[model samples]
Target: MEAFERARLNAYFARLAAQFTTPERPAAFLITHLLPERPAFVRAVATQTDLRAVLPKPKSIHAAARREVERVTQCDPLSRDLFENDETALDYIEARAADTPLVLLDVGGYFAPVLDALCDRFSGRILGVVEDTENGHKRYADCDKLPCPVVSVARSPLKDPEDFLVGQSVVFSTEALMRGRGDIMHGRPALVIGFGKLGSSIARLLHAKGVQVTVHDIDPVRRTQALAQGFTVARDREAALTGAGLVLCATGAVSLRGDDFPHLRNGAYIATVTSSEDELDLGGLPDVYTRTPDGDHVTRYQTTGHYFYLLNGGNAVNFLHGASVGPFIYLVQAEILAGVRMLARGDLGSGMHDVGADDRAFIAATWLNYFNR
Candidate 1:
């Protein structure tokens, strides 16, 4: 990391430590999908209050991250296995919260079950939950009421940094994949579904690379935005899928499935820039005609005469191919850390909320200064 970037991170964490240490520090439970900045964030949280327990997503914990988590939780006796599923995760949270009021520091909405469990068990004892993904925000959106406030860093302006990073990684990975397969993207038509932050970024990158990009989004506003950016907006799903050389899914909702198979051009590649579940209906697809693992990061799926390529098994391709979000992830992590403090301090209402504008401005300005300097 650059000197200014590191300084900004430390400064932000120090501010969080100051805000959360006074009055009375609440026990914090961190459930995260491990990322480059997570260990540092965990260490920072520990400096302000008790980090009660950690539950990391399965396959997310690495040697370094596990070591950091162990270092932080060595004092806590209730630490358990890395949870593989929601049921087990809920059990762990319920067991741990039997004695203490807890704050949830979450990524990928992994602690959503904890929030549900708290509603029936701990009730008012929950400090709050800080969520870091749009998928997570949607997961809890339908809930009539939440036991505590939810501060969503995913909905904040800090997401611009994440979008830029994601776009770069996606473009890098996609180009490498095409080149390795003896193909080129220039002059090829590509369809990008979902014009949200990540999707929009991916579409822009594709356009810049000389690919003829057509975007299909359910949201009228997003379609308008894509049109303004000089990309064709597809009016029909089948028309978008037909004859496209590359089809990228960016909607954090299911948009592609087996039913759409007939519309796909033969040899067309399907990949996702967002969550796998959000874009592809894998279960709805026919049995794989052939499966070949391209090392451990990619898989090729064939059905009948057509083949669909999945980058990183339809998960965030950027993470698998180009490292997770690159160094810019620290900026998003900083916003999350700020949300953690906001949740701990209280006064926000129950329901999903964006990171405060002041906090968002601080993070953005810090990053801009680092880049400009």
Candidate 2:
């Protein structure tokens, strides 16, 4: 990353860290993707309160991120701080900080296990949590009772624009991946398995490429919106899967199960847009088909006489290339910082909370002023 770009990131993050502060802040445990832009945010958090640890997502770790993380951690990074597995993170935090008061910053629901295990012993020690992704938001929401406040920017309007850009990147990366294999997306039939903000963007962007787009959303409201938007709604999912040359899982849930595999077209390509690895039953693929390594990011699965390709080892294809949103991601990152300040205050009750309107406006205005300049 350029020094100028790094300065820009720190500049924006500095504004948020300055805007939100509490007299007494809680010690923080952060879980985020190890991307180029991460170090700036990490430094921004340090300016406010105690930063106990940083746990990078396994799938999103890149060489640039490693260098940045090393410098950010002063080159003496903790072995427990750079975990790739969710369980390892849960175990470390649960063991080390079960008695220490903590505020958690989570992405992709890696902290969900901690929330589930929040019994009496862990309750007083955990001040609050800030969640970043839809998958993580859902995981926290599903918790029977949260002992502390959990704020999420997952569905906030501040995150909507970023999601659209992310949708574009998903297509951009996938097409780039496929182009490497001598495949063209134009005029090909594609099926998108979700109609949320991200999924809707994917559908529209796919249509823009002249690909016949079919959407399958379990939610009736989402399906209605997709149909009204002039995309084909898959009333017969099997038939849709059978005809689709490409299938993208956008739902954070298990979109493709064991039984759903037999319906796919031979030589079809599969990918996920969501951060959740559970979007597809990856283990179930090898159960029913012969799994073969196909290239850098491609995996071939032979189903009897027919076979299909999976991209990025069933993870988000956007991660194949670094999942950087350039400066647009700062809008949401700002909200996360604001969330950190909120958690430090310890005012809100236990449950999932949305980003405050003030935080949203500050970021939107910050983004507009900087970009428009």
- For lDDT, the strongest prediction is 2
Candidate 2 lowest-lDDT run of ten: 74-83
lDDT scores of the candidates, listed in order: 0.71, 0.79
The local distance difference test score of model 2 is: 0.79
User: Each prediction's Cα RMSD?
Assistant: 3.8, 3.0
Residue lDDT tens for model 1, 19-103: 4453556677776655545676777777755777766654345556667678778423222233334466556666666566567
**Which residue runs does candidate 1 get wrong by more than 4 Å?**
1-12, 19-22, 59-61, 74-90, 286-288, 294-296, 322-327, 362-372
Clash list (residue pairs), candidate 2: none
- Highest-TM-score candidate: 2
**What would the per-residue lDDT of candidate 2 be over residues 1-373, giving only the tens digit for each residue?**
7787667667777777888766876777777777877788788776776776677776776667668766655322333233344555556666645566688788877666645454344534677789998878888888888767889999989888889999999999899888888888975699999899889999999998899999999899999999999999999999999999999899888889877878888878888975445687766666678888887788888966888888887788998777767777878888888888887776788888887787788878986866555
